[model samples]
Target: MPDPVLLVLDTAPSPRLGRLTGRVDVRHADASSLAGLLPAADVLLVWDAASDAVRAAWPGPGRRPGWVHTAGVRVDRVLCPELAASDTVLTNARGVFERPVAEYVAGLVLAFAKDLPGAPELRGRARHREVQQVAGARAVVVGAGPVGREITRLLHGLGVRVALVGRTARRTIHGAADLDRLAARADWVIAAVPLTDATRGMFDRRFFGLLQPSARFISVGPVACVVRSGLQDALERRWFAGAALDVSEGEPPGPDGPSRDVPGLLLSPYPSGATVGWRDRLGEQFVALYEQWARGEPLPNVVDKERGYVPSADLPGGAGPDPGTGPRVNGSAAPPG
Candidate 1:
């Protein structure tokens, strides 16, 4: 019953929840301030799932909620020794973000290809140079998750041949063994991989060295995917073309900082999936999932604590997290075909 489903979530930016008035018992509380309220709810809506609070306080005195859902992508914050071992059925807003983020990656690739962000001011006639075309560029999208796959599909739409890599080798998808070879030939290296123990700081020197001087790197996942030191090396040496990151090892790149001084790096405060309809879709996801949960139906987009996410069952529903590259953050963007 909606009454038992304590919607213990941070307030959202969507007007869509205006319709869910008396159907559910919604308790709005910030993560830090949820000391006394969590135990009463049967299900807690962890809208801000990235917070340490979810993991810090769990199974509260044998009164924790039976189910918990996060609004964003990447459950690195959600899964841990205690939480994963519990009977709580963990699910995420997987279908909400894949395409929107794919669209964002496409935009960044186009921007870099054309130098749209920091172009040499077209007005002044002091220096007129030739503009380059992006038609024949090679783009490598890391991670074979939904988000990465979506990025690959979008790049392919632009005529860029994309090679996909996943954890295990399979038909049509490359495994870790093939990454370096793929990176070597790419004109654009997109980091759409997840943040697992195997992938943290995975974007180090060797990966950067593989890129051509003309290749750009775009990250739409956790910052930890790209080591800060390695990125600095590539920028300084111009080892590759440039980079546009939606996620970073250290975000809000310190004012008057290295990212600002870097020649070709275009850094923003991680806004890849901060678009319209995002919050509404999150609320919509909750509404739909609750419908299924109440009916005792098996929940879709379940998170596998061991592997982090349940593998994709069909073409549309596996391992999608938004960084929601903002709405949902990373992982899911558009499902990889």
Candidate 2:
């Protein structure tokens, strides 16, 4: 029997798939060539998780891959109506990012509290300013997923009170309804939810207005979840103390972008989850999942195409079980690919 064709949507440093060389026939494609190569592929590995090629090409393809996996946690970039409605199973790099991103959020909380971003400037100007304390601060971490849970755990270790909000209320996890009330009193409000119909533009003027004037905002989620203009206006008007965004809607604005001059605003080009050796880790993760698929066993991190995320049963007083293991799969059996 011919080896299952594994098509990779290539990126700068391609995933090292040497382990699969003998077991799979691997092919590479870019945005332009992706559609042409989709038909024969038994499995599609979206190595360039940031690209929208899958969304654009998936709808125009012949037979789509039996299983499609993205190396990123958020599947919105690759999800489209066609793929979502098909029998093809979709999965993401869920376990790989939780810890790194949570650590990044913790760092941002500390940086904001200590005003670390302004320290160099203060030294250069011979000026002094007082900074807030992180311990005893209150935080509202939206999204009850692994990343959010990790953030909550890290913040608690720092002596900060954290309110973890999810789609619905459960033991120790607040529901979406409590977000407004919680944000109003929080010292730090973090957006960690995935981008879905319900979450897109969730952080708008009203939500920003709900924050305390001295509070800080941090978003490690997709850029679309926050309204850029609303955040800009809020910062300019001092509605909140400050904000740090790791993701941007498009090509992040250049140095002269409109938000550049906005005081108390910091922007990073989506690097929260991208620690050193992240790509290699993602490669290893996909390889492991592929092996599971080859054995016709249940694949972990299988995304619910309709909902756009991996659904998990809520655990009492927590975000759920170990995310590295993730939710169990039931009917995702398929021939070795």
C-alpha RMSD by candidate, in order:
5.6, 5.7
lDDT of 1: 0.70
Error of 1 at 231 (Å): 0.4
Please, what are the lDDT tens digits per residue for candidate 2 over residues 190-250?
8888889888989999999999999999988887788889999999999999998875333
Q: How many pairs collide in each candidate, listed in order?
A: 20, 0
Q: Model 2 segments beyond 4 Å from truth?
A: 13-15, 59-62, 124-128, 248-251, 254-258, 314-337
- Consecutive 10-residue window with the lowest summed lDDT within model 2: 328-337
lDDT of 1 at 87: 83
lDDT of each: 0.70, 0.80
Shift of residue 315 alpha carbon in model 1, Å: 3.3
My TM-score estimates for the predictions, one after another, are: 0.85, 0.89
Where does model 1 exceed 4 Å of error? 11-14, 123-128, 247-251, 255-258, 317-337
